[model samples]
Target chain A: MLRDALLIAGKDLRLELRSRVALNQVLPFALLVLVLFAFALDPDRGLLARATPGLYWVAVLFSALLALQRSLSVESADGNRDALRLSGLDPAGIFLGKVLAVATQLAVLEVLLGVGVAVLYTTRITGWVLLAVTCVVATASIAAAGTLFGVVAAGLRVRETLLPLLLLPVLAPVLIGATRAFEAALAGSPSEGWPWVGLMGVFASLYIVAGVFGFGPLLEES
Target chain B: MTTEAHRQDIDSTGSNGTRVLGIAALIAMAALALFGLVLSPADANQGEVVRILYVHVPSATVAYIGCFLTTIGSAVYLWRRSRWWELVAYASAEIATVFTSIVLVTGMIWGRPTWGVYWVWDARLTSTAMLLLLLLGYLAVRRLPADHEVRTRRAAIVGLLLVPNVIIVRQSVQWWRTLHQKPTLLANGVGAKIEGLMLFSLFVGFIAIGLVFAWLLIHRFRLAWLEDQLDEAGLDVAIAERRAEGAAS
Candidate 1:
């Protein structure tokens, strides 16, 4: 099962490598979001610093949502999703592959978002390690949630309309945690945000396990 | 021998819907509305705004009931391979979403006077919104055009998965500090403000909306079955046309 999962993941990664879809579109989209934020807000340093964390997270989340929309759409548009299911590939393996691809895509966008926020707003960072750790936790949570919901949404006729409604509620916990962690990291306040970071870890782990277990029959039905 | 048994199954299921549940629902709602509006005393703090509770609380109760029924329907559908259970699930979900929206709106109206804001990021309100969205998603899945069996199975799976997510939405306020009021009622404790008459009214309201939901379920299921019959008829026509063309050729 692990071998199959890895092969599936590898295949998805190779697809992205060849297409460079994530690199070409996601990073640019994130940058454009940041630019739009800059345009919306006054350039006052204090105000920019105050709003930077939220702006950064929203940019990343929206960009990730976009990429996730594409990831699932790709599988379904070409009938690859049905093909994958019929190929005797484990549904869990498909979920894992898709999640990994989404996580990798989001992580890249998060980096660009972080750089843009830092440069635009001049955010002060206290603990680099904590920042890095929380980013990974947030990424995993978003990926797991997006993949699980993306599959369900993809099966619907009005998938694009239904995706956000299905995902945003489930994604709230992660969003809250990520915001707090990001805010703390920006403020150099370590103690207050640690719990939220821990919670994000829990959310990520639960989603991954649940998605893998639940994806099997869900995909079959879809 | 089994042909007669099959015929009976079809006949009963086809006709005996809505008559019983619908009347019961109407009676229950009329009794509950009168009791809630006329009998329940005004709150000490808020006077007329307190009346909104009759609408808000009942709506919330019905939504929860709807979600619970959906979960049960999903389980039954998956376990028994019964399309009837799927229809029940789909019908209940639509009713649930409607009630949830009513609850959220009434809560906001009540909050504006009491909290001095139209809305706040309170736990109770936020969770209810999340619940509404989940229910909407469930209902949307049911409406998607696909193979009937596949649609039913997929929706049942989504409905099954939804049961656990509600727990998160319920606890989100407690898990994080928020402005929303804590649950007014729970298993271990009684609400301080709840009077005997108010409690009774609430109970009546619950039963009333519940009956209405039950009635809606039966009626909607009948409609879904009618749709199935129409589809079958269409297929029969198509098959007949194909055979006629072949014969002519």
Candidate 2:
């Protein structure tokens, strides 16, 4: 399963490697959002610095939405879905592959956005250990949940609008968990971030398991 | 009667019998409103405005029940591939959404009189708002245009999501308690805090709302089942038309 997942993930990565849609469009969108957020909050004030964690996650979420849409759109075109089904690869492997590819893309995006917050919002990154752990867990949660809903929404005409509505409310807990953890790390209380990390871990596991079980049926539904 | 006949009879019997329950609910609401407004003494602390709890508590309870039903129906639908389960989930989610909306509106209206603010990021209220959003998502997925099977399968997945969300929303309230009161009703039940007439009024509110929910669920289930039959009939007609066209050619 892991080997099949890796093969699928490699294909997705190679596709993005060739296209760079995520790198050129989504990452810059994330950065631009950081700048816009700073402007909205008055860059000179310390308010932007304090709210950086929340704004940072919001940016990641929006860009993650874009990347998810793009990833599924790629599959929807040119009989790629039928091709996948015909290949006889495990559906759970495909799901895990999708999650891995999206998670990898998001991990890169989160790193760049983290730098953007540091640079634009002038908020220094302390508590690197806890901060990295929070980002890892949070990104996995978002990627797993996004891929599940993305495929669920991918086949419908209303998907463009429906994906965000369906995905966002469900991801609310992830947002809260990640933001709170980031806030703790930023406030120099890295010890306080553990419970929120646990929350994210649980949230991530729930979706990953759901994606594995539900994706095969969902993939066949359309 | 055969077992299948017996089951069908019970369903109809249950649904038809609830008509009386609906009228009973109507009477209960009137009495609830009256007793809550006049007979029940005002709180020494919260004043006459405390009357809203008679409505608000029941709204929250019914909404939670709706969520519970949706998740159960969703699970069964996925497992059994049953349209009955899908109909139940769809109807229950819509009812849950309405009840949750009432909870939000009533909570806000009641908050203004008591807390001096129309809204606060309190734990219970915040979680209730999240519940409403989750239900709205479920309803949106259901309303999306797709094949009956496609939509049902997708909506079932979305429906199953509410269980995890309910837990998270509640945990969030406890993890960061702000303005909202903690779980008060669970400790020794309603008999502990609310006495006599006030408790009686609250009980009436529950029966009224519970009966209304039952009434809505019955109608909605029937409507959804009819929709499925209509959809299949339409497909049959279209297929026949194609066949006739091919024969004419």
- For DockQ, the strongest prediction is 2
Those runs of model 2 whose alpha carbons end farther than 4 Å from true positions after fitting are: B1-15, B177-192, B238-249
i-RMS for every candidate (Å) is 2.3, 1.3
- Against the reference, the lDDT scores of all candidates come to 0.76, 0.84
**Best prediction by lDDT:** 2
Candidate 2: TM-score, chain B only: 0.84
For model 1, what is the error of residue B209's alpha carbon versus the real structure, in angstroms, after optimal superposition? 2.2
Window of ten residues with lowest summed lDDT in model 1 chain B: B182-191
Each prediction's total of clashing residue pairs, residues at least 3 apart in sequence or on different chains, is 2, 0
* lDDT (Cα, tens digit) per residue for candidate 1, span B85-180: 877888888888888998889888888887678776756677788888888778777677877766677677678767667765565445564422
**Which one wins on TM-score?**
2
The per-model DockQ list reads 0.50, 0.65
lDDT, candidate 2, A1-222, per-residue tens: 788899989999999999999999999898989888877898776788778888989999999999999999988898888889888899999999999999999999998888887877778788888899999999999999999999888867888898998888778878877888888898899887788889889889999999899888887866
